[model samples]
Target: MDQRVTIEIIDGVADVRLVRADKMNALDNAMFDGLVEAGETLKLNKQVRCVVLSGEGRAFCAGLDASNFGRMAGGGGGGEPENATSRLGPRTHGISNRAQYAVWVWRELEVPVIAAVHGFAYGGGFQLMLGADMRYVTPDARLSILEIKWGLVPDMAGTQLMRHLVREDLVRELTYTGRIFSGAEAQQMGFATRVCDDPRAEALKVAREIAGKSPDAIRAAKRIYNAANYRSAADGLMDESIEQSSLIGSPNQVEAVKANLEQRAPRFAD
Candidate 1:
């Protein structure tokens, strides 16, 4: 079997690809483990400044595999009795359940992530795409909320993510209908950052640009924006102040200024 996920880091950008192309990178049991494991590894790697996520071959992902649903219907979701007992209710990974962590981990990543989506992003796939800081999609790529059609809800942290990405009414409409939408519609609806013929290449270019900046500042900015979704304005302001104070005069920050004045690329520490 092919590796469900693969990571290749270069020039401070980690290229994360879902490699199970035959199944449309579907979320089978092993795929979930692979995704979480990959996310955890990147989280601890200081050398990584930015991440570009994509899938090999056709489709970003087609969401959960049908076999997993069979498992769920049999009174367990993991297909393993121990995990099936309470797959989603238990805090199997930090504050989120195991399944939720597979998607939420991206949000917790300290560095920025850009998703290069093609083919389609459906159900859990859509939620995973939303986890990225920015998303680039092919103009005609098919996408959908998708869970409702399966007699389920978007339970993989999609609810929390959708709140910050689009208006409440739009989220409600998508969640309710689970209708498919094109990438062009997604961009207009504010779900996608850019529509291009080659989303992966665009994502890599952006990731490289981001990787060129001061890593400390980039991380701090991500933290502030992540907090903005759920934090009070007063708390958000305080966090911005603290992050700014820490970044000022830091080695990387000083290097950034010096490099700018010297008209050279900044050499930042990992």
Candidate 2:
């Protein structure tokens, strides 16, 4: 709903874009709010079976806006802080503050969220990519943990998200140094799902493929995978069984089977 972010859904894939090309889609409070709002809106829409997230301009995102850097250190006097009175410790959006929710919302979405990153995804922007279930990046795109450059930490759920993607030592090294790395290195390092010459086009292709599946199965898979990271093997196994139990013989599942047998496209209900 916010102007900083926009959402458009077709078929079953939600195309979410960060549209602040002038600032390289940098994060300010408004950008964070916009992102969270879009995510929440889509979360309630059963028709949205997948999401393709990308930024509009030369870069996907450049991290926290440069101006905010001064204010975070308690110095910049010109602009208002993203709400000076709101301390970040509060769980404003179901286990995250508003800014954290900007990234975490992707994880919370029931369907898979894919990121198409190009140019540079720095500091907060890099963490933002981590939020996506899969990241398709340009081989030459720049990425970094980035907070260490300002003597700060990646507070936007970066610490929690990176641990699942890369090794602890690699995470520590990146967070400590804030050095930039190319997307090609990111794929090898486990940060990117794929490095491509045109990440957006590839991301959309993958998204469309996912969208064609049974939404019930896709959402269940997302839930199962999201819980698998922290839960025990037994619980994960039970989760798989529970989800399968619900899907068995369901209309969408039946349609899936019928479509395959008939050699026709499935018409799944939302």
Candidate 3:
């Protein structure tokens, strides 16, 4: 069988691809292991400054495999009695719990990750994109919060990520209806950062730019931004103040200023 995931490291950027193109990169046991292993590998790879995530072939992902659904249905939405999935991967609201982790792991990455999406990203696939720091989608790509159609809800990390990107009613509408929308529509709705003909190219263009900057500052900024999403305004302000104070006199930060003044490249430590 073909590898379900592939990771390539070049110039401090980890390029990750979901390689199961034949199945539209759908989530299955092997794919789950691949994604988790990828995320875990990245956690220890200090050389990595940025990550670009995308899928191979026609679509980014088509969600879970039909065979997974068949097993769930046959086992009453549970897993085989001897499997770990049996205890932790119940199919709740059309999405097995394990499937949700496929997306959630990206959010746990310390460095920034950009998801480059094309073609169709439906159901769990849509939620998978949500885990990234930013998403660049093809203009003609099709996206949907499609769990409702399968008699389910967005059980993955959708509920958490959608809270900031979409209005309450809009989230409700999409989740309740399982409506498919174009990438341009997703951009308008705040689910996508931009829509382009070549999403992967655009995402890499941006990731390279980020990789060229001060890694410490960039990571600090990501932390602040991520915190703001779930924090109160007063708490957010405090965090901003603390983060700024911490950065002002740091060695790497001083290097940032000196590099600009001396017109030399700054070498940052991980």
Candidate 4:
């Protein structure tokens, strides 16, 4: 994994931190690659029960390196144009093109992900946080759908994710206007799960608590919640059936019950 992103595990919680403090953890190609690599790491990590995603230094993320705008507009640096080449298949993840997958990888992870945001989460950065299962933001954190400022759209799966979290009209208003809002307003608008004095600390606390539970149950819960948004009521019900069928009578599921009954740690199999 790149040094720009750091993954450290304490017990079962993987603490993933974006370490580009010098640039407020801006989304350069390297940062994007690092984030995706981190997500991929979690996919095969059996011991990881949950992940706490936060940033080093003051801000969570400052969004697309403001300089990327120059590159996108056919200027130097910032690398090639995002749409310069068109490959096949799902670009990184659903809705997000490969250029936007830096943030979308979080959504693909089977385990729950919590984003702890503070300072600025603007444009691409704000969209990045949307990929997390829950967002715990500092009350003073600044967030926005700022792509409009550059005469662009939220192309990072922001539209798809926001529809599930906020009202359709509100999503339109925010995306169209590119207005900046505080975390307090975000919580009310349904973008933030909660606002706190220290969002990272609160998010880590929640992650640790979740890590103490049955991993199978948590995975099932995530699948159910994800399906609820993508599928119809009937299909969602069937999804529950399919997911539960795989979990039922499984070694981990049985160990969960045994641990609960014995009031001891679950010796779950990988």
lDDT of 2 at 40: 89
Q: Please provide, for model 1 over 56-94, each residue's C-alpha lDDT reduced to its tens digit, 9 standing for 90 to 100.
A: 889999998866555444433225544322334456676
Model 1: clashing residue pairs? none
Predictions ranked by TM-score, top down?
Answer: 1, 2, 4, 3
Order of all candidates by lDDT, from best down to worst? 1, 2, 4, 3
Comparing 1 with 3 on TM-score, the higher-scoring candidate is: 1
Write one digit per residue (lDDT tens) for candidate 4, span 90-192.
Answer: 3335444554566667876888899999999998889889989999998889999986555455666676678789999999999879889999999999999
lDDT measured at residue 143 in model 1 versus the true structure, 0 to 100: 97
Least accurate 10 contiguous residues by lDDT in model 2: 75-84
Indicate the worst ten consecutive residues by lDDT in candidate 3: 233-242
lDDT of 2: 0.80
lDDT of 2 at 104: 80
Instruction: Return whichever of 2 and 3 wins on TM-score.
Output: 2
Model 2: per-residue lDDT, tens digit, 1-270?
457999889989899999999999999878988988898899999999899999999999999887664443333221433333334444677666677788888988999999999998999899899899999999999999876555455777777777788999999999878789999999999999998999988988999999999989999998998887634433332332334334434456555545544568868789
User: The CA-based lDDT of model 4 is what?
Assistant: 0.77
Best by lDDT: 1
Please state the error at residue 173 of candidate 4 in Å: 0.9
lDDT of each: 0.80, 0.80, 0.75, 0.77
- Cα lDDT, model 1, residue 169: 97
